[model samples]
Target: MSGKRYRLQKTERLQLKIKLLVAHGSNCWWCEEPFSPDDWPTFEHVNPLSLGGTWSFENLRLTHESCNEMRANHYPISYEVK
Candidate 1:
């Protein structure tokens, strides 16, 4: 390791990252809700973190809880990236 320590624990970091990710996106990727800072939009990863993804702006997206759950463990091949 490079001797850097994490300011937040793994769980805390994941929570914070999800919050910030939704805030930065500001709307559901599918439904287009008017997201607010207080609103806890579902956290979505463009590439599954379990598959070696990282916490980056480009990898984050805003989604509804139901949508996120439905898409979990599934990847769509025909998604139109814009």
Candidate 2:
């Protein structure tokens, strides 16, 4: 296992979470489901940070905690923006 643990600091992570809430509202980027208040959310890197993705808004997504676990280190699917 790669012992390197990659992460954003607490405050920066919180900022990213706030941005995710604004950008995606209650939607889960991986599963496309609305988030319930009880569901904990996580920041998903659309482009895997391990593969050189930046911690920028354009590359981040809001997802349910479980969904993010399922999507680790993978590129997200593309869709035409309407």
TM-score of each: 0.52, 0.72
- With a 3 Å backbone cut-off (N, CA, C), the pairs that clash in candidate 1 are none
- For model 1, residues 7-76, the per-residue Cα lDDT tens digits are 3467865676666655665677756675666665765667666665555656667677766776674454
Show where candidate 1 strays beyond 4 Å. 1-25, 36-39, 78-82
lDDT tens readout by residue for model 2, 1-82: 1223367789878877887788678788767788887996887777777888777777778888888777667666643222
RMSD of each: 5.9, 6.2
Strongest candidate by lDDT = 2
Off by over 4 Å in 2: 1-6, 78-82
